[model samples]
Target: MSVRHDWYQSESKVVITVLLKNATEKNYAVKIGPKQIHMTADGYELTLSLLHPIVVERSSHKAFPSKVEITLAKETGERWQSLEQKPILVAPTIQTKNWDRLLNEEEKAEEKDAKGEEALNQLFKKIYSSSSPEVQKAMNKSFSESGGTVLSTNWSEVSKEKVTVKPPEGTEFREWEK
Candidate 1:
């Protein structure tokens, strides 16, 4: 299906807004890379190969009731002639990201702010949606049995035994009496 979107840019950042009617966090997934973006929601998919490289670690996105807004930090302040670059004929099997790039003061400060539980939940949903049936089963079984503390994608291991609760360090696991 077709995706409706609009984009605008400043010297250092580009913002893309994808219009998705009645879009919720459960129904959408957005993956951003240094030079590409992939968004899928409610049977619609939008992929963009950016005209210029971006600082992947500095990019951010937010979802509203009607749309998703993506903000990408440009590698340099130079203006981009267009949003999308020409499509490359061959797609690379592996793309490497340089996470060790020196962060500026602002980026370093932003890193201190935790993304919180909502982002973690969204990540798990994305993984569950994209995984195979066996993996999904394992995840569901393990998560349910372990009091939501464990999630495993390995069907062979999870199927062999019932997953026991293993709480975080310094925390004890307990079963409540009926």
Candidate 2:
């Protein structure tokens, strides 16, 4: 469906164009203004209105046509009446179902991660005795160097030694020194 709007300053009127297509194989009757336009398969309806376009579909189960064209006549002193009927009450339940599935997957992933961390901690305690001072010191150093946690087994280059630069004293500066 497409809609186009144009303004005529001289006449102080706006033209609206609406296009609608019926892709069904059967004939359909569409109410346009005071007339009902019958459209066959792949047929279209064109209307002219001075007001903005307001399209209404009678059936919610069937999809509307692919394209429709409408041209709005300029409103003089007469008011245009709408032939559109209220739509049926419907809510988007499919989107809610998909969201629930996503939430379930995320919860399962979190549970798996928690179990993996517990297993890793148990293995670390069994391989290295927690009571040993040397082991504790090594663990502390590792944690400190790794920013308090072993996130991964990957290693990166890190600066370990401190660097210092000293300025030399000249004889010209010694003359002013008290």
Highest-TM-score candidate:
1
Q: Write the per-residue lDDT of candidate 1 for residues 83-147, one digit (tens) a residue.
A: 99977688668767555654555576665544555578789999999999999999999999999
- Backbone clashes for every candidate come to 0, 18
lDDT of 1 at 105: 53
Backbone clash total, candidate 1: 0
Stretches of candidate 1 off by over 4 Å are 88-178
What digit string (tens of lDDT, one per residue) describes model 2 on residues 1-178? 2233222321322222233344344353334443233333334433333233322332111324653333323334343443233446797676445888899999999999999999998887765663466555555455555444332221221223222222244412122346
**lDDT for every model?**
0.89, 0.40
Give candidate 2 misplaced runs (Cα > 4 Å): 1-76, 79-97, 130-132, 149-178
lDDT of candidate model 2 versus the reference: 0.40
Question: Could you give me the TM-score of model 1 versus the true structure?
Answer: 0.47
